[model samples]
Target: MPAGQWSSAQGASTSTSDLSGRYGNGRPRGQALIVILAVLAGVSGVAWLIWVTGFHGRPLAQSGLTAYEIVDDHRATATLTVTRRNSGVVANCLLRAYAEDHTTVGELNFTLDGSDPKRVDLTKSVRTEREATSVELVGCTADGQPRPR
Candidate 1:
């Protein structure tokens, strides 16, 4: 209760010390909170990356239909370009033939033995029950769904 006085009271002792002395540099709380949040964010990002690339497996190939020739109503041939990497791992691609209305008329399952790095251009014959207009590559994967030993 006095301007210049000494007391053993609890609140009096806290007031006597300077604010910086009491809570070092006025940044202890904020600095600690920032550090904790940064660590958590880093850990969460690494976990998500592992889950995506490890469990889901990385893509090893991509395919495109370069050209198609309509041989007849029941059969056609298409030129396919496949770019594959990760040598020695088998890759598979799914190709589909579609009509003008985007209806799938036929499908082909193509496999690459993965002997070497691939920039392969090959012709494949596709068969449809009815006439089809265009050929397209649907998807490609390297995961062979290996059988458990």
Candidate 2:
């Protein structure tokens, strides 16, 4: 019945010491479990961050469209500059030529031998179904890896 006191369901007065003794070591129940779970979550989050940043951050190979020329109505030339992380692994690249309407008029699948330099500029002649206005390097992959999205 005191202003600063609490009563149990049985109308019995309870004090802070009574609650502390009811729990272990004067700490709330499940506090240790919550702390353990939080520590585990923190550890796993760090591990995931490391895996993402260290392993999957950089691509194996990269390509850039250097120059393109419309040789004729059915022919075009594309120059691609490619770079790879591992020079000992072979890399495959895709080049596409598009018409004025942005439709693919030709496509070329090329391979860079492992013996070649890590960074190389390649000129390829593409035979197209019609006149192509622009060319693009689609992507590149190494060691039979999946093409980059």
Candidate 3:
């Protein structure tokens, strides 16, 4: 491959790897736009993934609630109990629903407090309609108590 070419299944293609930043300008405007958009979208996607990795694939604790869907609001909500043996703080958790484009369109944050109870209420969820569904839970301090939103 040349300095400005990339190896491809078809043949040599534009050297996207040549771009110094998240985007490049070597390709035509349209191609560049597409590449730029795709790359930004991908980078944002991975970044968002990393940003939300704290709760990805995390299972909902049987203590509170299960993942449920409601057609009335086209949303789904669930609660997972988080108990840190080291800290021993409990909270009533509620996680709102989000879309694929990273847009928050439904529900409010769940509340978690050991002093209160171990139940979570998920609401205003959006089905996998337009954006990718996601949840934004409230963060807690070192004491294991959820901080005010």
lDDT tens string, model 2, 30-143?
887899999999999999999978765666788888889999999999888888887886888898899999999999998888898988988999999999999888878876
Give TM per candidate.
Answer: 0.62, 0.76, 0.30
Global lDDT for candidate 2? 0.84
Among all windows of ten consecutive residues in candidate 3, which has the lowest summed lDDT?
A: 140-149
Q: For each candidate, C-alpha RMSD in Å?
A: 7.5, 5.1, 19.0
Candidate 2 ranges beyond 4 A from true positions: 1-14, 17-29
Highest lDDT among the candidates is held by which one?
A: 2
Q: Superposing every Cα of model 3 onto the true structure, what RMSD results?
A: 19.0
Computed on alpha carbons, the lDDT of every model, listed in order, comes to: 0.75, 0.84, 0.48
Q: Write the per-residue lDDT of candidate 1 for residues 88-120, one digit (tens) a residue.
A: 767677777888788999888878896856677
lDDT of 2 at 87: 83
lDDT of 3 by residue, 1-149 (tens): 56876657555554666553557455668987898899999999998998667543332332323444444445555444454323234433445566666766665444344554333333334343443355554432323233422
Residue runs of model 1 more than 4 Å from their true location after superposition: 1-25, 28-31, 39-58, 144-149
Please give the range of 10 consecutive residues that has the lowest summed lDDT in model 1: 140-149
Error of 1 at 123 (Å): 0.5
Q: In every candidate, how many clashes are there?
A: 0, 0, 17
Pairs of residues clashing in candidate 2: none
The better candidate by lDDT, 2 or 3, is 2
